[model samples]
Target: MYCNQPPEKPGNKKELLEKITNMARANSLWVTAYGTGCGAIELRPLHTSRFDMERFGIAMRPTPRQADVLIISGYLATKTLKRVIRVYEQMQDPKYIVALGSCTINGGMYFDSYNTLNVLDKYLPVDVYVMGCMPRPEAIIDGFSLLMQKIKDGRAQGWKHYKENLDYYRENQKKIITDWDLPDYNW
Candidate 1:
């Protein structure tokens, strides 16, 4: 039973601007969804009124450029990894990734498949990983809540890690993607 309570006001005497910026960032997370596998089925229920994800400030965006969060809802095949990297690069600064499903975490049932990526974090920084064969809509909501809390606390700095370690991520990516010809990042 994970609690989805809103983050408490920080009592730390931090800069007002930074606090406000994080508040805004945490409040409005535009998601770029890559519903690639079984988790896709689970993600759809979020859009319907039953889950009602919008009240929590999580909404879907069609393009990565317009989104702040990338939800990778399934396993990463070698081919899918390329597109995921491309999309991650296109997103704005201070972005975050919320990976769902055990497959995306450790290849799950696809661990034996040579084309399946065993560990997603090897290629890109993953901020939140919701475990389970297919995390239920409630669990996905809990994941988003966790991410929001991280953002508000300034703990969700995976984007910074990715930027500082771009070469490392790229190297790992290239090891699997043989015919790599992705464009340079817009940074």
Candidate 2:
């Protein structure tokens, strides 16, 4: 798509290019790694010096509020769904969600499992979907690049999108299993 990408402003193509290049070099991406499954094991290379995502302005953060990107790495069970929504809501505006595996995209092997959600998009808006049983470090880096472009252009309207669809989300949230549903076997 960059072959003949249009300039941000007709009179200052060079300036636009520079702005994009700078963002790329800033290592400015703040990621909250929500590792939910075995797929998270693949994130090791991205965090380590081998892939060194730090070079792309993408680094892990401890809190969602401090994050600009939320990486859903692996399958999410029904019990974890609520926590995911809470965390996603806590993030600052313009945040992006990256589904890091086939399991997250379609539940992979857990498609038939009652506890596994079919797709992360069912609960959260996903900006980029990385397809693999587990995506490689390079794929993750590429996803980061895509996300940076979106952030730079101010196209990720997470807050507005969620607010408009709050009721739909609330109804979906209600369908998920709860602790109250567990039978009182101990009793």
Candidate 3:
């Protein structure tokens, strides 16, 4: 969707153009750098000047509420998996979750581990899956570029669908963890 502006006055073309540009920039697309596992370490280069993800108009956001994309970097333990759901819930509409590593895709090295969840999709809907034990910086950049294209084409699902599946997601989350499951250390 194009950026909307209030009615333009006779003398405000320059200001209007500036506003439109900024609005387009703001709405173009934004991603939240949600690094849940070891693959997160590789995100460093993607954000650096060398790879320079910003040049493609993909800016990293600090909070999920304002973000349009959430990058789940690597493995998800029961503990961290629960938090990922919470963060995903907080994000605004039109959000996408990209699973970064094979771990996130299918548990990678933790395929048989009890603490790790085998597949992120079992808990959340993943839009893009990048396959690698620890994907190189270029792969992350490539994934971001592909995701941006999908966003521009209006192919990405908005958060409303996620909201609709809230109960389903909650049920899946229940398979992971709860405060009652924690061990008591009191003496």
TM-score of each: 0.90, 0.77, 0.77
How many clashes in each candidate? 0, 2, 1
lDDT against the true structure, per candidate, is: 0.86, 0.72, 0.72
Which candidate would rank higher by TM-score, 2 or 3? Answer: 2
lDDT of candidate 1 over 37-131, digit per residue (tens): 77888989998999989998888999998899988888888888888888888887779999999998889999999888888999989999999
In candidate 2, what are the lDDT values of residues 59-146, reduced to their tens digit? 8898988887777888988888777777877777556788888888888988999899997776778887788877887887787777
Stretches of candidate 2 off by over 4 Å are 1-27, 177-187
| TM-score, model 2 to reference | 0.77
Highest lDDT model number: 1
Pairs in steric clash, model 1: none
- Residue-level lDDT of model 3, residues 1-187, one tens digit each, is 1112223333555766655544463346677777899988998887788888777777888998788778888998888976787777677655788888999877899999989888887688787888898999899877866666665554555344445565576578776776634222210
Decoy 3 TM-score against native: 0.77
Error of 3 at 23 (Å): 12
Candidate 3 ranges with C-alpha deviation above 4 Å: 1-27, 180-187
- At residue 3, candidate 3 shows an lDDT of 16
